[model samples]
Target: MMRILLLAVLLLTVACGTVTPPIDIAPDAWISYDHKTSYFVSDAGADSVRLTVKYASFTFLDKSAELLPVAKSVFQRISNELAEKRGTVRAVYDSSKFYESVAYNGVSGVSTALVSNELTFSAKADSSGTPTSAIEPVEIVQKLEALKKALDSGLITKEEYERKKKEILERY
Candidate 1:
């Protein structure tokens, strides 16, 4: 009877064990998309600005109504902050997501193209806004050199090397 009880407890424990999903870390230049919203953060001068855009289905009228105000409020707050910093934030609001690009003088701004079927808007920046492309020239040169070496060593094809080289140059 004790053996049966022990076996039952072991089975219960095994069955109850929960497996958690791994957390995702956002990349250096891109922000992680949340279930209801996607946001990007950029630094301008000494200040950092976050641009958040919420998503909701248009078919769900109640849900859309609920989320629209929240998205507007968040956008307003970010716009106010940027204006205070003498910065500009541009965002495109589609039915599902908000794609944003923010630019400010004297600071690194996030600049990304936002395309939507409904609307497009932009605010100009005084300074060049290409933080992600601000990779060290030396590093890019090194990577190019490495690619060439790979081609020479027959580790990669000439076509692959050229494609990678073009991609590297486009970043600048």
Candidate 2:
């Protein structure tokens, strides 16, 4: 009976270990909006811009272990907009997208290369300009909602949620 219990515990450990946590943008990430574009820069650094959406409803994926389609679309749109605005964009390091490239590609050869490449290039292009302090109130609300979702999903602790909430509120 002891051996059987040990085997069950080992199996549980292995099962839990295999489950990957969902990906979320940082609470302290910077958001900058200019005209029609809204840039959600990664808190990690200027190297990565988490999401850039233009005139669209941004939805949060529940319990998603991989980068969701909506998120990809936002990134892709940002890339296109950057190319249109600046004529060209240079590449930069992006850890989250890099992980997605490796993990997502391995799961299903449907490459997320475009999302990574576009964001990297755009980050470099946008880094040159000064971000405006003025951001749309709607955008701020959306970001807060995203953070709240992260908290609800157990991706962030209550303390983290409050801290991030305060930081975001201070922006406006």
Candidate 3:
């Protein structure tokens, strides 16, 4: 009886004393698509983020419900931006079996491209040991501009340029 009581108290103490570290949200550079769609990226507390995106189609023509060519262009531009980021999506699988969702599982990291699609943005760490992104918005724009110029100059073929550009934009 005494052992059982002691075990209960110990379990209670352990459960009650558990602590969750604080998170930080900061801006990161090298994480760009276009000014119009950049707002979709947001830091989830400090450790993670929620990346929601909508892509565009340049080849698609205007339809009855479709707003206009201008809208289609905008959608295509946004889609291009989103695709740029998607290239870095590494293959990751959950390790935990049953209770994996309840525990903090470490990330598996991102994949590497053969020619490299987008630039790397370093993660920011705060005093409390929280990691966040430190990429700037303007830097992303400049990179996009450079990419666009390279494509326009024929340095990169239309297909290759469009593909790579799309990958950069997809990074949510």
Clashes of each: 1, 0, 24
Q: What lDDT does model 2 reach? A: 0.46
For every model shown, what is its TM-score relative to the native structure?
A: 0.25, 0.26, 0.25
Candidate 1 Cα errors over 4 Å, as ranges: 1-132
Clashing pairs in 2: none
Candidate with more favorable, higher lDDT: 1 or 2: 2
Worst 10 residues of 1 by lDDT: 103-112
Tell me the alpha-carbon RMSD of every candidate. 16.5, 17.9, 20.2
Candidate 2 per-residue lDDT, tens place, 11-85, comes to 665433221212443535525444323444343344434333322221222123343454455556555565446
Give the Cα-based TM-score of candidate 2 against the true structure: 0.26
Q: What is the lDDT of residue 103 in candidate 1?
A: 17
Across 26-132, the per-residue lDDT of candidate 3 in tens digits comes to: 44523444542222344433323333222222222222123223333443344344434443212111212111001111122111110111222233445554434
Cα lDDT listed for each candidate? 0.45, 0.46, 0.37
Task: Please report the candidate that would top TM-score against the real structure.
Answer: 2
Error of 3 at 74 (Å): 40
| lDDT for model 1 | 0.45
